[model samples]
Structure formats: C-alpha cells, structure tokens
Target: MNDKANNIKRQIAITRRDELGHPPLHLDNNSRLCLNCNRAINDEINIIEADPACLRLNVLTQSASQTCVICNAQEDIGRLTIHCRVNVFIEVNIYIPDNVRSCEHHLDENGMFHNRLLPGLRFINRPYLIKGPQLQLFLQHLRNVSANKVKGIDDKNLTEDEFKCIAPVSKQQFEELFTYCDPVYYNGKLRQIKRKDLLMFLCKMRQGLSDDFLKIIFDYHSRQTVSSVAACVRTSLLERFVPTNIGLQSITRENFIEQHVTEFANELYNPRPAEPKVIAVIDSTYAYVHKSKSFRVLRQSYCFHKNRHLLKPTLIVAPDGFILMICGPYFSDAGNNDANIIREEFERDANTLREWFQNQDIVLVDRGYRDAVPLLQHLGIDHRMPAFLQRGHRQLSTEDGNESRIITKNRWVVEARNGHLKSVFKFLGQTMNLQHAQNLSGFYRIAGAILNRYHPLINMQDVNAEFARQMLQRSTVPNAIQARVEVDNLRLRNGQWRRLYGEDVPDFPLLDLGYLKDLTMGIYQINLAPSYIQDKLIRENDKELQLDEHINEPGFLRIRLFSRFRNVVKHQIFIAYTANEMENIDNNADNNPISGYYCTCQSGARSLGTCAHVASVLWYLGFARHQPNIKYPDTSLLDTTLDAAYRQPADIAQNINVDVIDIN
Candidate 1:
C-alpha cells in the first residue's frame, strides 16, 4: 500500500511540473520496470522518471522500482480523489480545505475488487504544499467564500432603520457616495469590506461607539483593524466629501446672497440703506474632552462655565441654518473666547471672512461677541447683538428690550444649527479621549459638512418680515399696566395687590390655538405655555401668584408671577378681559374678546404678540379652568419648591425679601 501511494505521489508531482511548463524527464528502460508489480514500461508509452529531490518522495531504489504505466494509472485515481474532496469541502463551506483523500482499494468478502485505500491512508492529516492547478483551485474557493460573506452588504440587505442606525445616510445615499468616492483599497490591500460597511464604520464612530462594540457588530477580527478601517474611511470622507460641501470657498457670494441672505433682507433691524446683502450668525460650541496628562493642555482646555475640559469650535452659519464655515477648535481658555476667535479670523482673514463680507453686511451674534463689535465696525460691517441688562435693572427698557428680542429671534437659528450638529454626531456630545483631541477640528468640520448637505434648513421658511416689523412696532408701545404698577408701587404694597388664588382667578377671554399662534406670531411660545403653566402649578406648588385690583381700570388685572428660570425673580403681567357680550368669539375675525395683554418677559413686552407667560395665564384662566375636572399634565421635571437652594433655607422668605404670595 505504501509503495502504491508513493508511486501515485511521484506521478502527481511529475504531471504538475509538466503543466507548469517543465519538460518531461526521460526514464531509463531498466528504471521504468517495476520490481514488486513485475510490470515493464512499454516503449510506445511516454513517461517521466520522477526526481526524488523535486518530488520530496522516498524511492525504495535508484532504478527499476516501479513501472510508469502503474504510476500513471495511480496518479489518475489520486487526481480524481482530490477533486472529490475539494468539491465536498467547497459544498460544506470550509474556508481552508487542507485535507483531501480517496477511499482505500481492497478485495471484499465476495471476491470483488473494491477500489479503496487502507484505513490509515484514506484521510490525510498533513497539509500538502498545493501549487499550480491546486493553488488556483484553492484561491477560487476562497473567492467563493468571501463573495458569500459580503453578498448581503453589496445587495443592501439591511432595512432602512437598520441602515440609519449604522450609517448617517440612507442606503441609496450611501450607494451614491460610494460610487462618487469609488474607494477601491484600504490598508494597502484590495478592500474586503464593502463601501457601505466602511461608511457604517464612520457613522458608528460619530455615534460614539467603542471599538470593541463595533468589532463585535461588524464581524471584525480585531479592534485594531476596526480602528484602522475607520481612520481610512474618515480620511476618504475628508478628502472627497468635505471640500465641496463645506468651507466658505465652496460657495460663491452670489449663491449665498441668493439662497440664504435675501430671505432676511426686509427683516426688522436688518441694517438697511447699506441693504446688508448677507447675514451670518456666529457662535462657539463646546465639546468636552478628557483631562490631559500635559498640565498646560489640561489648564488650557478647562472651561470655567462647564467646569470641565472642553474644546470650543466657532461656527458661522447662514440665516437658513446652513453651516457656511467652521473655524478653530480653539481651547476653552479666556484667550480663545468667541470674540478673540473672530478677531484672529479678521487678522488672518481665515476663509476670507474680511474679503467676503461687504460693507454693512450684518453679523448676528450673542453678547459673547461684544468685543468683536469694534473690529467689525472698523471693517464697516454691521453687527447686531442682544441688549445686555444694566447691573441693577431688572429688564431692558421697552425699545432696547424689543430690539434685543429681534436680535435673539434671528440669532436662535445659529444656536439650533450648533445643536443639530452635536445631536446628529454624538461624538461631539460625548467626552472625547485625550488622545483624539487633535482630531476634534476634523470631526467638527466633517459633521458640519454632513449637516449642510443633508439636514433640513434650521429656519425652514423665510422669516416673515411683515410679522417682524409688526413685532418691532409692538415692542415700542409702552405697557400702561406696567407703568401704573410701577407708579403706584403696587408690587411693594401687600394690601393693594392681593394674592390671586382659586376663586380669584379672573375671567380670561377664550381663544383657539390658531388665534393664540397669530397673537404670539409663532407657535413655539404658545406650545411652551402649557408646560410653563403646569410647572408653576404642580412643581412650584402654585406659590407664586399675585393680583393688584387697586387700579380703577375695570376688567383689567395686574399680576406678578414668579419667573420660571430665576427663583428670586418675578415678572409683572397684565390681562384685559371683555364683557359677557363678547363671549361668542369669531375664529376667523381679526377682532377677539381678549382686548389687550402685556408681560414683562422680553418677548411679551413686544406689542406684536404676547409672551408665553401672558398666554399661559389667559389659557389657564379662560379655557383650561372652564374644562372642569380635566387634568393638566405636569411637563416639568424640576421640583423648584424642593430642589431650589433658596427653598431649602429656613429664612428663605427673609433672605429673598419678597412677599411669599401663596396660591390655593
């Protein structure tokens, strides 16, 4: 049996070498004669003498050991056995088919010749060095295995939600980007992972998933490989996607004016005559980072406001909430404040902000950019910011406060844009590793680019300039009730202003939500009114309500309600109700039963519409109270009565020095 196997192995080696372009070796006549089988090679048959060195075979003798015909026949059977094993291994989905064998040849009890090898030789345990045709076959088998594994990803087998969880874009969008990027290789090899899978890696990174978790989900062999793949994908996205979609240079001034600027042209306080062609809102957003080992870095990144290590990146967004450009991910130190960043941008002309911004082009900002105002003025750029309250004053004067509201109303979009970027890319929300601190800017820019291209406009529709103008006009109107309250010192005199409670709740004019929205000029405040009212009612234990009936104005009530935000502060508001004759209010008519209202809240002070505080009082008094036994939901999580530090103090009333007006 061993001799037969050896003879078969020799024949296979010779045949493989011949197929590999090696000429057949000549065999001597005596050497072609088999000693044990007693068969001689026929002269008509061509056969090669196997080289023991090349074949790695143990030949029993130097010559006449085996006949070429017997070897040839054995080689054919061996080849057939290997092919059968290969098919079985392939069918069973074996990744590496190293062992293949044929059945042992033997005589059965019935004297029939059964072609099967001995039991020991039937299945080979050793892996042979496969070459030539066998090597090609093995590679082809590997190809089949890989194809099956990646078939699902290539065919987009994942559902929409599943794809969304794994990638920022939809499957269709991913495919389109993949085609555009055409990333063919990664880590110096032909990419085994599909383009969608690569993008999934990037998306998962943005979602702030750990490498270990990603590896388990993506079926990666190691976390290091996952990191490498993610890095490669990030590089590709930065090189291929970010440039065209982000940065000031990517967009033309004409396009910016046409698409984003024109909408705010007629907006209140839009810096006209100069006819501000563009209005860009700028603000800095913080990204928390792990404390660094380097003391200098740790000190520089520490933010006094957040009480943590943070990186602040300044974002400039168009009125439509498009992120036009991203500036330095400057350290949170005082030197890198928003104003300083803008100053540096002007000095460096970063993204050509100085060149692109024309004279009288408006830059809407928060008070943080107060220092930049002088610089902007020097450049002939108009800057608008919310008015800051004087050190002792409780609120800005009517005109100053109203103009501040206009600035705030327009500036809020940039804040929303910043929030959108952080919310969509959770990595920015999480505390970043110290090691990855340098990559913060790259990630920020990339997230901004993605948002600019995919997210809906922050301000979905153009600002209603007419509504804004009306609001501006309303803001300038002096509040007669507030004026009267202040003149009579009604807030300080307890007898003049009685605590308004359950039975004292005045009759407020009933108005529908549409009418309320029209009065407020937006639904946000009206929608928030319920939650604010509920918070005052349930969370603050309804302890902050007061009414002044001393004024001779009939059907008018002056009340001071505790501020939802500040424990020690309260806002004075006025509500005017109509006579019973106006009970049946027409929804479509401009004239409503609610004749006039005012609240000291910045927005409420505006004449165009009422603030949420005034709206809440009217809704609760007129509509909500009439719907008897209906439970109002508590929308606030804060327990101001219990959680507030002032509430905890035993002498809280004395410390605050304000009357603890109680509401039943």
Candidate 2:
C-alpha cells in the first residue's frame, strides 16, 4: 500500500501546475519579473524561482537595474558596473538611487564620481532601497571622506587666513591661479588630481618645508611623491603662468614707462625727461644654500662677503616696486659678483633684455655695480650709483652726498622689493637644500611671477611724492650749521662744554612725530628711536657717556654715539634751535624753531637729511622724553646672554660653577 501511494505522489509532483498552466506557486512576488523589468510577460517565462533556504540572508547586489545611470549604457553590465556611493549624492546634490549602476568610464578608479561628469547626473526621484550592510558601508565611507577632507590640505578644509599663513597668497588668489595650471592625468588608474598639487608647490616655496614634512601635511605617500608633485607643478607654472606675468618679455618698455614709472623716480633719476625712458632700480639678493661635498661647487657657491654658501639673483624692479624682470641666480664666487652677473645678462640679451632697455634709460644701482657702469655707458644706458668714498676723504663731499642721497632714495625700491620677495616666498630667504640647488632659477621665476600677479604694489610713489619734493628742495640747501661748527672749532674743545641734565636746558624744542619725520625725511631713523633711547636707559655697561649729561649751552645740544661697526670710534652730533620753544611747529613752515643739525657720520654733512645718530638724539630730546609710559624694546633676554666671540673661558667657568648640575 505505501509503495503504491509514493508512486502516485511522485507522478502528481512531476506534473504539478497552477491555473495559469505554470509551475505551482509561480505567482509569488519573489518570482515577479515584470515588476523589476519592463519586459513582456511572455519574455519572463525563463524566470527561475529564488531558493528560500536562507530567508534571513541579506546579500548586497550591484544594482536594481542593468542600465548605467550616468550614460545609460546597458552593455557589459556585470563587468563594467560601478554601484554609486552615498557621497556622490551628498556632494553633488543629485540624488543617486541606492545600488544604481554606472559605467566604469563614468567614475574614477577610486570609485568616486568623476569631477567632469558629475554635473551630468540624471535626476531620479525613486525611493532608495538599501540593505543593512550597504547602509553601514556607506556610513563608514562617508566618515572617512569627511575626515580626509578636514585633515588633508584641501581647499575646502582651510580658512582664508590659514591659506595666507601657509602659502603667501590669499584664498581668492590661490583659487584664481588654478585656471593657468595644466590638468595632467593618471589615466591608467582612472584618477585625475590637481589644484592641491599647485598648493603644495606654493607651500614648499612659502614655508620652505622639507619634502618629508610636506608629505606628512599633504598626505602624500612618500617624500619622492611630494618632490615629483612639486616638479610637475613648477614646470606647469613656468610654461603656462610665468611667461605672461614676469620677465622682460612679459611687459613692453612703453607700457612700463606709462604704467609703472613713478613721479618720485622721474624727478630723482631723470629730472623731467623729454623722451619716454625707463627708470628702474637693479640689485642682487642672496639665496643661502647648504654646503656641498664637492670642493669645486663649495668654492663656487661660497660667499665671503655674506660668510655663507649662497647664490645671487639679480632683480630689476620699477620705482613703484613692480618687478620687471629677474636675472641669473649665479654662483656667489668672485667671478659671479653683482656686476658680472648683470653684465652677462646684458651681453646675453636673454629674452631681448638689451632691446627692452633702450638708450637714455636710467639704471639705479648700489656701489657694488661700479664695474658695470662702463658697460652701461657703452650701451647708452644712463646709470646712477651711490658715490664711492675718495681715498683721502673720511666723509663724502657736500655735492657727492646730495647726489648720492637722491640715488639712494630711488634705489631703495629695489631693496624693499627684494625683502618683499623673501617675505612672501621663504624658500628664497632660507637656506635651501642641495637637491634644490639645480632648480633655483625656475623656483625664483615662479615666485616672482606669483608675487607680481597677486601681491599689492610696494612703496607706492603717490604716498611719497610730496616727501620726495621736500628731499629735493632740502638737498640744495648748504649745511650752515656744519659750517658754523667747523668755523668755530667746536668739535675739538671739550672745556667749553658743561655737564647738564634735561631740566638744566629749559629751552629745548619739543617735537612731534611729523616734525621729526620731516627733519629726517624718512621713518627709518624714527623706527630706531625707541631702541637707541632704550640702550641709554638700560646702561648695560656704565663706561658709555650720556648725551644729555654734556649739553654745551642753551639752544644747543651735543653728544657722541659709538660707531655701530667700531666701538672705539665716536660720531659727534650737534643741534641748534630757537630758545623757549615749548610747542611743535609745521614741518613745512619757514619759521621752524629747529634751525639746523650736523653730524660727523660719513653722509651727515648732507643738508638733505640728518644721520641716524643725529635723528636719535633729536627724537629723544625733542619728542620721546616728553611722552609718558613709553614702551621700549625689551632687552632682558639679550642682557642675560654673553657674547660667545668675546667670552673668556674663565668667565664661562665662573658662571657655570654657580649653576652647575649635581649628578650625585
């Protein structure tokens, strides 16, 4: 009986069917194909029933559909499909259905949305279906992306101040520079990265950080990666960016004269020029480098003047502090001095520099370029340099001093521009590595271009036009006070002078900042006023004589300040003023109470301006002492330290014994 029943059941199971003449339980939702695909019902005849063996298993699927959401490509669905991630929707604000398929070409190898194709994402309003594991995976991935974005040197991660502090350019300037960079590819890896590499290059220039440290900050895999990135960025900038911003070829001589030339420069150098001629200041700045193992390179790079191994890059800048061109960063040896480097630059005519500079153009330089003056004259270029001290003269003559002051005032722009360059790109100022020595030219060019494009003009002429006119007017006046001192032989006699205090002189002229600035014609001396006064007040060594203690007579003050370079030498300073002057007067007024000033410094005899020592004395007696609770520079740290060069072993032993360590 059991055998007959089993045979009947097997026959019935083999022939099992529903009302639709299909397999039994064929109407189940799990077997529904028409809902998942928009195919005809008959085409769904090949649908296989899903096994219900593990009802709790939640396996992740590639997508709910075979078509790519990005490009709508249907072929090779299984091989080329990339399931969209949660970050894609969050970043682009285009909803990507969970497990939506995308072609491999549409996404980056990192499985992220392509930057170029992200905007083309099709709109989808369908509800998302995510399994538990998929949701958990997405949450973890999002956490990682967020953390990396914050921790890495990404543009979105840093604030405007942070960008300037790290890189030298503002946030907007940094962003604007991206348009000039070329987009390179790692197509084999299906990844495209940029901008951050440019930023890394800037950071390298601005902070002067080592490759290893840069690698850590930028999340690069190794120091070699950082170096390669820097190299690539530098090349890109040199080719695409630098040519349009810096160098002699970038700007025309006519445009430079019209746009960059300043009134002060014109009046000081050319003096009401009839023809359009270029007036620029030229100078060289040192870029310190590490000592090399090769003796030849060491000999070539060593600078005896600066006492360091370095390179010299000659800068050509307009009087308004606009950089016009940069020349060779030649070796720092004797053969590659400033004059030779500049002479070579002119001789080579690189980038048509010789053509750019025409005849009658004035080149303002310091005394170091004296050898190049003949060459400049040969080329029909007028050159103005500071006057060299004659062999027998301890001081420059009045005419030489006046002419040199005008040249120095115009030449100051180049020095200020050099300092600006170092401040912006610290790599130029700092001691660079030997590995970077070969790329110094490219580095300097890039730095100059960026500085020109982004930074504001330094030492603008409009702010100093009146001041320059005043300097010119003052230069013509004779030093009446100096003549009087010399005629009376006041400097030779000490018996005529009497020791007196500030109260003893009841008629000294009290001055304000503006009057003092007019007397000096610049702020450099005023900036040093507090420090000089502080030096006297501190009295580190009591052997020095005080200026206020030896006033000679009413309406006159005299003092001596030790030479900065030589302590054994002293400079005599004298100031004559109207008695009973208790208030400040207009700096431009003719009836000024302070009649004249004189000093024994090399350039002190010039009536155009007072020497630093004279300015310090006048500033203190007339202005600084009258102010209450003035905060001077702190010198406590310096006072505590001893000079290693002058320190004796016995003195060291005595100090060390008092603070000796007790290891026992």
Candidate 3:
C-alpha cells in the first residue's frame, strides 16, 4: 500500500512539470530537440534553474539539468571552483588533428573509442568544427547562424593539471554544483582573470602612470589622446580640491597684524608704532648695479646747504628707528636743491599738513632746512633745527645747561637717519656719476618701505614729543601722524617773526623814511644823517661806557632789527653806537671817547648780520630806546621816589585805564 502511495505521488509531480511547460520526458543523453520544434533542433540556448528539482543542478548536465526545449542548446550556469570537470565522454565520431598533440593522445583504438584516452575529450575549450560533416549540415539551414547552433560533438578529456586549473579541490562533493565564471562587469569579472582591461588597470595602479607616461608605456598614438586624459585630472585637482581651500594670496594690514604681530612681537621686541608701546625707526637705502659708463652725472651746483657734493634722498625717520618717509630719490643734476624739493613736496599737500600741525606736534630736521620756516608757516606746523653752535645765538643761554642738553639730545634722530642710509646703501651715500642714478633713486624711496614692513626695528627711543605734548593737553592722535617738527619749526620760526612785527604797537610807522636826507634815492626806514646820528647815539652810550677803547673794540656801533622775536622780529632796524672811549687810546681823543654798540642781526656786522650805516641812524634817533636791552638798559626802571631827594615815589599803574589790545 505504501509503495503504491509513493508511485502515485511521483506521477503527480511529473504531471505538474508538464503543466509548467518543463523539458520533455525521457530526453536523449546525446541527441536533442526543441519542445516547440521537433525537426533536428538547433539554435541559441538559455539555462534557467528555477524549479526546485533543477535549482541545485548544473545547467550543462544535459537531461539531468533543465533544458530549453525551444532551442535544444545548453548553457552552463555554475560557480567556479578553480577547475573544470573531467569529461571521459564516449569519444564518438570527432577527429583530433595529428598536429594538436595532447597528454592522452590515443583515440578510437577499440573503434567504440575510450574517451579517457583523449585528454579534455569530454569537454574542452570551444573551437569551431567547421569542416565536420554534422556541423556543416545544420549550419546551412540554421536560423541565427552566428549563435551557438549545436552541430558538432566536442569530445575531449581533462588531464590532471588541466582539471586542477579549472576547479579547486574540495574534501567532499554534493549533488548541488555552482558554475562561476566571468562577472557582471567586464573590467573585473573574476579577480584573477587576466583580461586585456585587467592588465591595463594594473599597469595604471602599479606605475602611477600619468597620461603621458601611460601613452609612452603603451605606445599610444597621439598627443590628443594623452592630453585629454591629463586635462581631466588637472581640472579635477584645480576645481574640486585646490580652489575651495585656503591659498597664498590673502595678505592685508589688519589680517597681517592680527595673525603675525603678536607672535612676532613675542619672539623679539618687534612692537610696531601702531601698538602703544612700540616705536618705528624709519630710514632709506639705495640699490646700485653696473650700467653703461657713459651715464650722465649730476652737475656741480653750490649747495649752500650741505656745502658738499652729495646725491641724496631725504629720509625722515622716527625717533624709534622707524622710517617715517623716504621723501625723495631726487637727482642732483636735476636742478633741485634740497630746500626746493622739500618746498615742492610740502606745497603739494600743504593744506593737509597745515591741518595736522597744532600746538605741540614737533618736526626734527637738519640745518639744510632753513627755508623750513616759511613752508611750514603756511601749514601751521612747527619745526626745529639742531643748534649750529656756529649761528651763535642764545638758544642755549649760558645761565644753565638745560637748553644745550635738550637741543643736542633730540637732534640725533635726523643724523642717524642720514648716516644709516649712507651706510647701508653705500652707493647712494656718495656721489653718483649719472647712469644708474635714477634707478638708485627709485630704489632708495621704495626700499625703505619694504625694509620697514619686513625687517626688525630696533633701539627706538621712547620719547615721541608730539604724543607726550598731546597727552598733556588731553588730545587724541592719528596712528601715522607725520608731524615733522624741524620742517615745521623752520616755518614757525619765520612766521612768528612776521606776526610779531605785524602785531607790534607802532613805535613809529615803518614808513617812507627815504625823505630823510641820508635815506634819499631809496626806500628807507626811520632814516637819519649817518654822521649826526652816529654822534648822538655814541655820545649817549658814552654816558655809561664812555665809548672807551675797552668798549669800542672794532666798529663805531652794532645795529640789528628791533622787536626781539623768532628767527628775527621785523625789518625795522635798531642801533646802539659809541662816542667817548672808556679808556684814553693813543689813536682817539681823551675822556671824550666815542661810544660804540653792535647788533647780532644782518643790519650790523658788516651786513653779514646787520650794517653800521643803518645802525648809526637807528641809534641817533633814539630808536635804540625802543628796544628794552640795547647798548644800555632802558631807564624805565627808575622810579621818581628813587630819584627824589625827599623820597617821593613815582606813580605806579599809570596805564590802569581799561584798554586791552588783542595779541592774537
């Protein structure tokens, strides 16, 4: 009963296969036919293992595997195991060419043919059997003739080496088998499969072959092919990687100071002027190189200023060793004096400068800047020059050494700038011949700024006069304020004199004294007879000095401008003369010695400082009295009480009436 039940179940399963359009029952082992066409079936093939019974079987198992009844062709769908199956097939009517020798060479020895005798005879690599009678017959009428039209028998057996190369050895075998071969992707179908594409890929990876390198490696035909490959890589690197990140171009003052200044300052003493505690020391240097010998040299002009031949650039430096301005790289033969160049640059921005110079901002300079006074006057700037111990005035009074100390101590900045520039840019320090001069000029002007921006500044003096003065007055200052003191002092010194003269209470109208007898034929001031004026002034001075030989050393009188003020006060001249000698000299008469006086300005001193001709008249007319300290002190100090025998005091505060004059 149980056996009968099993037989029924098997019949039912077979019935289901027929219903699902499965392969025909009782199919031939070697001969085949399509389910749809019965006439000697031959066409392309497909192997599908979808049903439970066929799913675990290899496709090429012929009848044991599922067959495509529509084509009668077979396909192997199996996993690779590093080996191919040995097929000791019934080596039927296939001919092996004598030239194609094999490990197992004999075939059809018993006529029925031992398949094992023909190595790879059961299934070997496919090769066309075009001359075979069976294949020739079907190919003539085959549809899709280019496809796998089964027409010939491939009877080949696998040798031990060939079998192992095709399939990996395993300890056990199972009914289910896998057919693994080429992958879905052509480039990397099987990892170890050495296809043409695989070899090329490996060449790229191993050698890091760039397009050009690869082209030469493989002997590619043209530059266009290699260039196209390289351009893609280059474009990718530039746009996708390099451009989106930080690069080398972003340098600015604020960015630089923030990123580097603190770290740099900590490394050294590189505090900048922008920082509160730092000072900048600025100076100019020049660059020189060989040029044609026929270059033009600067012409010889008497530079009353330096009194020496020089090709110079005006380098204004800070007290802290920072360069403030490298004003020029001017040419010597360019017909520009130092003063002239300075004036031109000053006027170029006069209004801005005038606005900058307030009460205490100082400019330090050298004596070549005598014209500094006028230029700065227009700008409202104050300037200073070091005491030329030769000019011989009372800037440093002998009373105390304070004035001398102040002038000498602060004057080194300008000198240092001049010396520093000459030393570093040695060619510029000396005279230039001509050819390389202009290039050197540009170098000198620009090099300092470059040096200052890059090099270390050192030995900066802490005193910034403007900063200190403004601090006292409670004022704010600009970061790069170039309140050059000496340049301004020169102007202020002159301007103050002009103002002093302009503001003075008219002691006499600075008038047409040309009408006076000695002043005839020329515009003159407070003119008087030279001889008569001389007698009167000298006679008066003799009342005290007695115009003795002791007092009358050289000339009869000394004359200078009146109104004691900056540079010099006014054009109005004053004279103190001598008549009687204090001692009886053999050359002149006795106790009636003529009195003598002199002035420090141009009106006296043989017209170097001042002249005697003008001096005499100024003294004779008592214009000398207008000046408080002349040859003799003014007698205004004498009170009536001191003079009265009865001790009656002269009136004090006589001008108590309210009449105010505005000095400004």
Q: Quick one: best TM-score, which candidate?
A: 2
Residue 331 of model 2 has an lDDT of 95
TM-score of each: 0.71, 0.78, 0.26
What TM-score would candidate 1 get against the native? Answer: 0.71
**Tens digits of lDDT, candidate 3, 1-664:** 1245334333433443564457856523343334533221111111111222322111121222332222233453222111112122212322322122221112121122232333323221112223366445434434333243242111124354442232221112100111111222212221211122222222332233444555554344454544333333222223322222112222333433444332222212221334422222222223222333433532333233545444546665544444545555554443565566677666775574334334333455555566656765655444654344446553222211222223333345556655555554343444544443544444353334323443455443333434233222321211110122223342233322322221122222221122221221111223222333323333333221111111322222222333323533532232322332222223323431222223333322221111334434433333332333323222234343255444322222221112332111
**lDDT against the true structure, each candidate:** 0.62, 0.71, 0.33
Better of 1 and 2 by TM-score: 2
Per-residue C-alpha lDDT of model 2 across residues 261-357, encoded as one tens digit per residue? 8766776667554465799889999889999999999999999998899998889999888889888889999999889989899878845877888
Model 3 stretches astray by more than 4 angstroms: 1-309, 331-337, 351-360, 388-396, 399-401, 426-433, 460-664
Candidate achieving higher lDDT, 2 or 3? 2
What's the lDDT of the predicted structure labeled candidate 1? 0.62
State model 3's lDDT: 0.33
**Number of clashes recorded per candidate:** 9, 0, 81
